[model samples]
Target: MQPISPIGVVRGGRRQVHEDGWGSVVSRIDLDPAVFDVSATSGLDAYSHIEVVFVFHLATRTCTGTQHPRGNTDWPLSGILAQRAPNRPNHLGVSVCGLAAVDGLTLTVHGLDAIDGSPVLDVKPYLPEFAPRGEVRGPAYAGELMRDYF
Candidate 1:
């Protein structure tokens, strides 16, 4: 299996600041091209957006159990497959970050939530052909989360 190490920190988003000086986990992610080398595709630049996958290294220790919706007590505790909590058995996170620029192997993207030195997993060009469409269905918490946060 191929291993991936983090190249640098991503800016943007207001993830929480951790006690260890690392910022809060992000709801999104941006990967570095200097490390990714997506240029081989030739059409990588054609897409304005792409998805990022990264590891939650901090969770390497006690990251366990599917959480109750961002650690809120009001939300019911759920299992790994039920919710998108990072504390799952794998501790991996994925998000679609907007590509601002791509210079050779160096890429600039927005909306990544990784801390200053988190490990990156992989990057893929988001193709519309592969996009999923249809009435989106999921948990009934978009409004609940907003109220809980605000």
Candidate 2:
């Protein structure tokens, strides 16, 4: 497949991910004003949340095979897809965050799990109908890894 261009860049926030405070951490997704139409975000504020698809632009390398999650041996080894590791083949990340506000081509959001300067590929309003229909389940190790990732 061909690569895609970023619609915008993330800004105004802590440069690194923290173990906590994501709920209160505020950041901005600034769309490329030249290519993106501000009107595209006209009704996005109606939703309380948004799904941001971004690129892990800061990842130093790509992982095409299995590796310990977070480099913690205590967690079982698993394929890249089994964990939310940033070093994936495509280096893509999707985060659902609370929509704090929207101003023109800039969006202020809370709980976005990406670092500063991350390239935003797309932004979709969060809708109830798109949520999972059944109970969500995952491995025990996945829980352990996320215990402090928030």
Candidate 3:
């Protein structure tokens, strides 16, 4: 099997900040402008949002496998595949962030929840057809807090 190599590294100041080993951090993505110049998206300002793929660099190997999750403690533990926990076997993170603006090959995005210096895997324009539409379904109480869900 081939090992996973990061396409790019995240540049942020996120780090372990809790005694419990948990933390809150923000991240920034630095993309190579030259890479985009050859593509149709050379003028990225045309899009309003972008999808970013990054690595959970802070996730220790021990954090992988299974977890009961915060509110679902009474619902029995679930394997990583069954949940959205960051401590997965692969430790990869994907998010769709609002496009604050596009400056040359540099893009300023909003709402990327990751630590600084995380490894970036890829980035793609957010297409409406690629995104979900209409009603969303999920565990009853689990879906609460629409704003904080992400």
List the global CA lDDT of all models: 0.58, 0.87, 0.62
Total backbone clashes of candidate 1, pairs 3 or more residues apart or in separate chains? 6
For this target, which candidate reaches the highest TM-score against the unseen true structure? 2
Displacement of residue 94 (Cα, Å) in model 3 is 0.8
lDDT, residue 88, candidate 2: 98
Q: For residues 81-118, what per-residue lDDT tens digits would candidate 2 score against the true structure?
A: 88778889999999899998999999999889888999
The deviation in Å at residue 10 for candidate 2 is 0.4
- Tens digit per residue, CA lDDT, model 3, 1-150: 976556555565345422221122334566655444635347667788788888878877545556766435665566777665677778888877777665555556666655667777787888899767888776554544233544
Candidate 1 regions exceeding 4 Å error are 1-38, 60-66, 146-150
TM accuracy, model 1: 0.67
Alpha-carbon RMSD to native, per candidate: 5.4, 1.6, 4.5
Q: How well does model 1 score by local distance difference test?
A: 0.58
Worst 10 residues of 1 by lDDT: 19-28
lDDT of 3: 0.62
Single out the weakest 10-residue window by summed lDDT for candidate 3. 17-26
For residue 41, give model 3's deviation from the true position in Å.
5.3
Candidate 2, residue 115: the lDDT equals 82
